[model samples]
Target chain A: MTYLIEGRDGPWELVVGLEVHAQVISQSKLFSGASASYGGEPNTHVSLVDAGFPGMLPVINRECVAQAVRTGLGLKARVNLESRFDRKNYFYADLPTGYQISQFTHPIIGEGAIEIELADGSTRMIGITRLHLEQDAGKSMHDQDPARSFIDLNRAGVALMEIVSEPDIRTPEEAGAYLRKLRMILRYLGTCDGNMEEGSMRADVNVSVRKAGEPFRTRCEIKNVNSIRYVMQAIEVEAVRQVEIWEGGGSVDQETRLFDPARSETRSLRSKEDAHDYRYFPDPDLLPLVIEEAWVQDLAAHLPELPDAKCQRFQDEYGIPRYDAGVLVAEQATADFYETVARGRDPRLAANWVIGDFFAALNRTGRTIQDSPISADALGGMLDLITDGTINGKIAKDVFEEMLESGESAAEIVERKGLRQVTDTGAIDAAVQAVLDKNPDKLAEYRSGKDKLFGFFVGQVMKAMAGKGNPALVNEALKKVL
Target chain B: MSLDPATVRRIARLARIGIDESDLPALQRELNGILGWIEQLNEVDIDNVEPMVGTGHAALRMREDVVTDGDAREAVLSNAPDTAGPYYTVPKVVE
Candidate 1:
C-alpha cells in the first residue's frame, strides 16, 4: 500500500532514494597502509598519502576492491570489469588533498535491485543505481577545545562504497526496510560492518512529495542520517515541509539539508551559491580499475547463502511456516543455530522451542544468539530426550530451566533431578489404578458419559506419579482401565 | 563554450583563487582561447567510439592489505601549518 500524508489540498505521496556510504571492511585504508580499524588515536592511522603530503601518490588496496565486488554480487548487481576513478575537486579543513577521489561517470557496480520485505510481509524491489568506491575525509572536531579545532586524519583515505539507489521508495517504512535489508546483505557478505552508530554506514535521504499520480518534483537531500529510525523520521518531516512549501506558493530550492533529529526538522545546509562544481576529472595517478571475469564469478560462487534463499529453503525443507522461516533467517547466526537444532529432529517442535521459549529467554536476559546460555547442540539433545520418551513436555521445560541456570547438559540435569518419565506400562497401570481409586466419584461420572471428567482423572494420575509418568502411556493406561 | 568576466570571477571564487578584479578581462580571454582550441575536437566525427579516460590500458595496480606505514607521528606532522600534541590545530571552526 502506498503511504500518504494528508495535506490541506489532498493526500501527498513521498518519493525517496537513499545514498548509503558503507565503509569497506579491510585491514588497511584504500590508498595507504594505515590501519582501517576504528577508535585509534587521532592521526595514528595516517600515511603520507593519506595526510596529503607533497608528491605522495595513492596505491589501491586489492582487498578493498574485492570487498566492493563481493558487496555488489550480494546486491545482485552487475559488476563492471573496467571502471575509472575521478577527482572531485573541493576544499575543506578535513580534506587535505583539496579533492576527493571518487567515481563519477563510471562505477564498479552497475544497476541492480534489492528486495525489501515490508512489515506487511509484502516484498518490493528497490533499484540500486550504482556502487562506487571513494576515499573518506578526515574528522574535524570542533568541541575538543574552546578556541581551536582539532583534526584527526585517521579516517582519511578509508575506502567507502557509496551505494546509490533509484527513487523507488515511496514510504518511510520502505526506506527503513531497504536500509535494513542492505545492511543485512553487507553484513552477510562480510564486506562492511554496517555499524551506523560508529559511522561505518550512513544514508543521505532524498525526499519529495506530490499528488499521488503526479510526476516527481525536486527533492531535498537530508545529509548524514546515522540511524534507520532517524532516516524514516527525516523523510516524513522533510516531505511535510515540502508540501507546505509547495502549497504556500514558494518553490522548494534544491540543496543539501541537515536532519536535526533533536528538533525533528530539516534545515538548509547550503543554498545554490554553496553548490559545488566539483570539476570532476579522471585521476591521473591511478589507472582504470579492471578485474578478470573469472574473479567476479569466483566471488559469486563463494558467497554464503543469502537470507532470502535461506528463508525459502527453510520453509520448503523444514515445512516451517513463512513467519518462522523469516524470523530464523533474519541473522545468519540465528539461522545456523536453528539448523543445528532442527537437523534430524522434529522441525516443527524445534521451531516452536527456538522461536518461542528460546527467544523469550534470550530477550529476558538481554543476550543474543551468540551469547545464549542454551547451545544449539544442547537444545537438540533435549529434543532427542523428548523423542525417546525419556522426559515428557512439561518435565522438559523444567530441565531446560535447570540447564539455563547451571549450563549443564540436558541429560545431566535430568539425571541429577531424576525427572525421567515412567514409560513402563506395569508402573503406569498401578498409578492409574491409584488415581481411579482416589477419584471414585469422578470415575463413576466419567463412566456415566461425563467425558469432561476424563481430563481430571488424567491430571490426578500424572500428579500421583509426581509428574514423571509419560503422558501418552498414562493416557493409554487410563483408557484401558476405564 | 565562451567564458565571460563574471563567470571567470565566480569560478575563481569557487576554486578559492585570489584573483584581482582588474585581471578578470585578461583571464577571461585566456580561458576562452584555451576552451576554443579544445572545442576544435568537436569537428571530428567520433560516433560509436568509446570515450578514452586515460592514455594507458594498464589496469590499476593494487597493494597488499597491511599496515606497513604510519606511526611516524613526528614526521607526519612535520609539515603541518600548526600542531599541538600530535594533533593538527586550526582556528576554531563553528560548524
Candidate 2:
C-alpha cells in the first residue's frame, strides 16, 4: 500500500474520519415552507424562520424527518426513538439567527457500517460514527460585491444531514471510497441528491497520520469539499502535508481548513469548533422528536433495497458480473431502468445497451435517466428486436437513433427505413455471392488464412444491400464458402 | 475548563465578539460556568457508547460508475470571481 501519509516517516498511518454535510432531499427548508431549490433568485427562498427574526420559531418539517429516517435505515444505523434539536450558538453574518438548530447529544442515527468497493474489486467496511440533523447556515457571498459580504438566506435553515464517520479509514482510496459510498447512499435514499457542486453534499475531512498502531493524533478538519473528486484530492494533499509536517518535528494543530479546488491545496481556515464551545443545549421551544419503534419499523419496511443488497442480488439473479451489477445498482433510477429492461431478456445484453448506447444518448442529449426520450419499455423493445434477430445490433443502432428523433418504436423505425435484419438465406447468399465475385482478391486473402478480412466481406455485402441484409445469415453463408 | 483572562480573550476572538478588557474576568467566569455545565457528560460512562452518527434507519447508498452532468463547465464556472473561458481564476495562487 502507498504511504497514506505521504511526507511522513516512522511507519505513519492515516486516520481519516469524515463529517459529511448532505443537504436533505426535501421540497422545502427545514423549519419553513420555503422552496429549497438551488440556483433560485438569491435569497428568494427565505421565510421569516430562515431570517431568524424575533418572532419566528422553528417548525420542524415532517417530510424532512421522514427523509432523514429513510437515510438512517439505508445506512443500517440505529434510529433514536427520541431525538431533539439543540441550538448551536454562534455569531456570523450569514447565520441570521446567531445560532444554528442542530442535533447534538441526541442525534437521530447511531452506529452503522458502509461497505466500500476498492479499486481492486475487493471491499472494506467503514464505521459510521453518527448522523445528525441540522439546519444549514446561509452562504456568505464575499464576491457578490467589492466592499460587502452578501448573505444568501436561501440556504438558511435548509435541512442538513451531517454523517460523521469513525477514523476507520487508513488510506486515501478508502477515504475516497467511503465518501463516494456515502454520497451514493444519500442519493439512493433520496435523502440527499448528492449535488456537491451546488453545495448540497459537502464534506469536512478529519485527517491525521500517526504511526501504525499508535493512537490517533489531533486531526485537522478540512471543510467544504464541494465535489467527490475534490474531497479525494484534499484528502491526499492534506494527509501528505500533515505527514511531512510531523516528520519534520512539527506538531499537528487541530484546526479547520479549506480546500481550494482550483489549486488543489488545503489552507487553514480557523481553529476547530468542538461541541462544548458551541454551547449546545436542547432547543427550548421545540419539543423532543418522540419517534416510536413502530414508526421506525414502518419506515424500514418501506425502505427500498440499498446499494450493497441490490448489487449482490443483481449479480446473483441476473448473472451479471460484479462490476456490472455494482454499476447498474449504483443509482436507484438507473438500477430500476436496468431491471425493467433486463426482465425476460438477456441480462448482459440489457446491461450493455443500458450502460453503453443508452447512456451515450442520454449524455449527448443532456438528459438524465429519469428524463430520457426513450422509456424503459421502449429500450426493452429495442433489445427484443436485436434478441429475436429482427434487427442486427448495427441495425438496432440506426433504429434507436430514429426512435430518439421520431419518438417511435424499433418496429416502426425498421418498417419506415427498411432496416430489418435480412434472415432470408437465399437473399443473404445472393448478396454474399455478389460481394465475393467483386472481391476475388479479398476472397483469396480469406482462403489463404487471412480470416480477418472476412469481416470486410460481410460489410461489403451489407453495404451492397443498403445494410438491410441479415448479418447472421451472411456469416453462415460466408463460412460455408470459406 | 475555567476561562482565564487569556482564555476569555481567545474565545471572544474565536466567536468574533469584541469585548472590553475590564470585562474579561466576568466573561471568563460565565464561560467557565457554561463549560462546567456541559461537562456533565463526563460523569456518565460513555466509554463504549459510539457517538451518534445519523437519525432514522441505517443503510448505505451507492451508485453505478456513471457520470451525470459532467458537461456543466460553463454553468458551473459562471459563479467564479474571474473566468478564462471554462476555468475559475484567482490571484495567481502559486508564488
Candidate 3:
C-alpha cells in the first residue's frame, strides 16, 4: 500500500470509520406502496411519495422498523423504544424533496461491537457507532448527454439502514474485515442480503492519518465504495496521502472523496459536512417511532444463531476442522448443503467430499455450490456406498465424473457403468496368480523383499479386472500369495 | 461564528453554489438562523433515548440460501446510456 500523494517529512497514522448503507429487505418502499424489488423497469417502482409530489406525507412501515430492531439486537446494541425521523435538509437533482427524511439526533440502533477476523487468524472488535434508517436518494446520471441530467427515482424513498462505525479501524485489512463480518451478521440476522454489487449495500469509508497515539486527525469520507477490494484500496491510498500531507508540513482537510476503480485512486468531491451542516430537524408530519418492549423482545427471542456462533457449532458437531467449518458456515447455502450431506453419513467424510471433490467439480464447471451437478443426497449416496464397501474410495472418483457427465444418481451411474468394487476373494486370487505366473520376474522381485513391486502386481490385478477390483480385496489376495 | 469570506466561499463550493464575495455576510446569517433552530435539539433530554433509523418496526426478512439471479445481461443493460452489443460503451481511449 503506497501513498497517493507522498511527501514525507512527519509521521501520521490513519483513523478510519465507515457509514454502511444496507437496504431493508421488505416488500415495499419506505413510505410508499411501490415494490422494492430490484431489476425492475428503470422507474416502474416509483410512487407518488417517491416522486415527491405535492402534499405527500410519509407513513411509517412497521416491517422496516422491525428489521432495524433485529439488526440492533444482532449487533448486541441497545434498541431504542422511542426514535424519531428528522428532515436532513439538502438539495440535489436526485432528491425529490429538498430535505431527506433521516435520523439525526436519535438513531434506532445504538452503540455495538463487531468482531472482525484478521488475515493472520487473529480477531479484533470494531465499534458500531449507530445504525439509523433513512430513505435512499434517486440516482442522477451525468454521462448520458452533454446537456441533460437524468434522475432515476426508483431508489428514492427506498429504506436504508446506515450503520455508522466508530473510528476504531487502523489498517485497510481491518476495514475489509469489518465490512465482511458486518455483512455476514446482517445476512445471518436476515436483515439484508449484503449484496454490495447490487447497490443494495454500500460503504462510505472515512480515512485520515495522524501520529499513532495522537488524537484523531481530520479525515476524508470516500463515498459509495461498492466492493471489498476497492474499499481496502481506498483506505490505503487515503491513509498514505494524509501521512504525506502531514509529513510535508501541511494539513489534512475533512472532505468527501470518491474512489476511481480505473486508476485505483480517490478524488475529492466536496468538504465533508458535519451534522449541523445538514440542518437536521424533527419531521413535522411524522411522529416519533415508538415500539413496545414486548414486540422487540419477541424479535430478539427468534433471532437465528449468528455467524460466529454457527461457525463454532458446525466445527463441534461435524468433527471438521475450524477452518473448514468456517468456510462452509460463512455462507448459509454452503452450510445447509453440508448439513444435508452430513445428516446420516460420516460427518468427516461428508465434509471432505463437499469441500474437496465437490468444490473442485463446481469450480471446474464454473458453478457455485448451489448449482453443483451433484445434489447433497446424491453425494450422500456415494458416501454411503464407500462406507458400505459397495464402492471403494478410489472408484468414487469415477462415479463422480459419471454423475457430472450423465446427471444420474451416483448409485445408478455406478451400476450402469459397472463401477462396483470387486470383493470376490477367489476371483482376485485367480487374477493375481495368473499375473504372477506370467510375470515371474516381478514375482521374484516381491519374494526378494522388493515390496514396492507389490504395488505393480496390485495394479496388474486391477487392470485384469478392468479397474473395478476392490483395492482392499486385491491387497489381501496379494498378501496371501506372497 | 462570523462567516468569513473565505469560509463562505468554501461552503458555496461544497454545496455547488456560485456566490459573490459581497453576498457572503447575508448567506452566513441565513445559515446561522437555520443552525440556531437546529440547536434547540441540544436542549432535549435525549441522553438515554434510542435513535430510530426508520419508521417501521418490523424484523429483517430473509430468503433461503438460494440464487435468484442468472445474470441476464440484456435485461440489465436495457437501461444503460450507451451499450455496444451486450457491453456498456464508453469513449475511445488512446486516440
Candidate 4:
C-alpha cells in the first residue's frame, strides 16, 4: 500500500529521492597533501593548496579516486573511464577558493540500483542516478564568538562522493531503507565510514507530493539531514506541507530548505538557484581523470562479499530462515561473529541463541558485537555443551547468564554451579515418582483425561529435579510410570 | 545573453562583492561584452565534435594519498588578515 496524506482534494503520494555526501576514506585531501582525518585542531590540516594561496595547484589523490571506483562498483554502477572536474563558483567565508572543484558534466559513475527490504518483508529497487567526486568546504563556527565568527579549515578540500538517487520512493519507510542499504554497502566496501553523527555521511532529501498518477511536481531540497530518522520525519512534514499548499489554492515553491528536527518543520533556506548561477566551468588546474579498465577489474576482483550475497549464503549454508539470516547479516561484525559461532554446530540453535538471548543481552548492556561479554568461541563452547547432552536447554540458559556475569567459559560455569543435565534414567524416574507423590490429586485428574495438566506435571517433575533433568528423558520416564 | 544593471547588481551581491550602485551600468556592460565573446563560439557547426575539457594531455596526474603537509598552523595563519587565538575571525555571520 502506498503512503498518502489526505488533503481537501484527495490523497497525495510522496516522491522522495536522496543525495548522500559520503566522505571518501582516504588519508589525505582530494587535491592537497593535507590530512583528511576528522577532529583535528582547526587549522592543523591546512596546506597551501587547500588554503588557496597564490599560484597553488591541485593534484588528484589516487586513493580517493580508487575509493570512488570501489564504491561505484559496490553499488553496481557503471564507471566512466574519462571524467572531468569542473569549478562550481560560489562565495562563502568557509570556501577559501572562489570555486569548488566537482564533477559536473561527466560524472564518474552512472545509473545503478539498490534493493531495499522494508519491514513488511517486501523489497523495492531504488535507482541511483549518479555518483560524483567533490571537495568539502570548511566549517564556520558562529558560536565561538559573540561579535565575530571563526573559520575552521580542517575539512577543506576533503574528497566526497555525492551519490544521487532517482525520485522513485513513494513512502518514508522506503526512503529510510534506501539510506540504510546505501550506508551498509558503503561501509561494506570500506569506501566510507557511514558515521552520520561525525558528519562523514549526510543527505540532502528532495521531496514532493502530488495526487496519485500525476506527473512530478516542484520538489524542494531538504538540506543536510544528518540522520535517517530525521530524513523520514522531514519527508513526512514536508509532504504534508506541500499537500496543504496545493489544496489551499497555492503552489509549492521550488527551493532549498532546512529540516529543524527540534521543531519537526522544514523552513526555506534559499529560493531556487538554477544551474547557471553556479557558472560551472572546467577546472584549468587539473586534467581529466582517466583510469585503466584493467585496474577497475582488479578492484572488483578483490571486493569483499556484500550484505545481500552474505545473507543468501547464510540461509543456504546454515538452513536458517530469511528473517534470521537478515538479522545476522545486517552488520559485517555481527555476521562474522555469527559465522564463527555457527561453524560446525547446530545452526538453527545457534541462530536462536544469538538472535534471541545474545541480542537481548547486548541491548540490555548497551554493548555492540565488538565488545560483547560473551565471545564467539565461548558461545560456541556453550552450544557444544547442549549438543553433547552435558546440559539441557533449560540449564544452558542459566549457564549462559553465569558466563555473561563471570566472564568464564560455559563449561566452567556449569561445573562451578553444578547445573549439568541429569540424563540418568534412574534419576529422572525418581524425580517423576516424587512429583506424582506430591501431586496425587492432580495426577489422578490427569490420568482421568485432564490433558491440560500434562504441562503442569512436566514442570513439577523438572522442578523436583532442580531443572537438571533432561526434558526428553523426563517425558519418556513419565509415560512409562503412568 | 544581455544583462541589465539590476541583474549585474544581484550577481555582484551573490558573489559577496561590494559594488557601488553607480558602477552597475559599467559592470553590466563589461559582463555583456565577455558574454558576447563567449557567444561567438556558438557559430561553429561541428555537431559531431566532442567537447574538450582539458588541453595537452587528457589524463590527470594522480599522487599517492598521504598526510605529509599539515601541522604548520603558524605558517597557515601567517597570511590571514585577522586572527584570534588559533582561529581566523571575521565579522559575525548571523546564519
How well is each residue in A1-482 modelled by candidate 3, as lDDT tens digits?
A: 32233346444556789999999998777776666777665555666666666787677677788899999999999898877788997767667677889998888889999998877788888999999989998766666656556556667777899999999887888889899999998998888999999888999998877664678778788999999999999888777777767776789777788899898888878534432377678887777777789999999999998888888988888788988888788878888899999998899999898889998899899988768878988889889999999898878988888888888998898888788888888888989999989899888878998989988998899889888788988999889888
| Model 3: native contacts recovered, as a fraction | 0.00
Candidate number with the higher lDDT (2 or 4): 4
Give a tens-digit lDDT track for model 3, residues B1-95: 34566676767864768888788888888888887888888888988788653455343222322222223444434545655443334333110
Residue-by-residue lDDT tens digits, candidate 4, B1-95: 89988788888877878999888888888999999999998898979989776578879989999987978888888999998888888888754
Model 4 iRMSD vs. native: 1.6
Please give the distance, in angstroms, between residue A148's alpha carbon in candidate 3 and its true position after superposition.
0.7
Segments in model 2 whose C-alpha atoms lie over 4 Å from true places: A1-11, A32-47, A271-276, A439-460, B1-3, B7-19, B22-95
As a whole number from 0 to 100, the lDDT of residue A476 in candidate 1 is 88
Q: What's the i-RMS of each model?
A: 1.3, 13.1, 10.7, 1.6
Q: Tell me the spans in candidate 3 whose CA falls farther than 4 Å from its real position.
A: A1-14, A271-276, A434-460, B1-95
Ranking of all predicted structures according to lDDT, beginning with the best and ending with the worst = 4, 1, 3, 2
Error of 4 at A103 (Å): 0.8
| lDDT of each residue in A1-482, candidate 4, tens digit only | 47989888778889999999999999999999999999998899999888888899999999999999999998999999989899999877788898999999999998999999999999999999999999999999999878988998989999999999999999999999999999999989999999999899999999999887899999999999999999999999999999999888899988888999899999988656532388898898988899999999999999999999999999999999999999998889999999999999999999999999999999988999999999999999999999999999999989988888899999898888889899899888888888899988998898899988978989999998899999999889888877
lDDT of 1 by residue, A1-482 (tens): 78888888888888999999999999999999989988888888899998889899999999999999999998889999999899999878788899999999989999999998888889999999999999999999898788888898989999999999999999999999999999989988999999999999999999998887898899889899999999999998999999999988898888899999899999988757857688899999988998999988998899999998998999999999999999998888999999999999999999999998899889988999999999999999999999988999989988988888899999999898899998899999998888888878888899899998889888998888889999988998888989
Between the candidate structures 2 and 3, which one is better when assessed by lDDT?
A: 3
Q: In candidate 4 chain A, where is summed lDDT lowest over 10 consecutive residues?
A: A268-277
TM-score to true structure, per model: 0.93, 0.81, 0.82, 0.97
True contacts kept of each: 0.78, 0.02, 0.00, 0.90
C-alpha DockQ of every model: 0.70, 0.05, 0.07, 0.76
TM-score-superior candidate, 1 or 3:
1
Please tell me how candidate 3 rates in CAPRI terms: incorrect
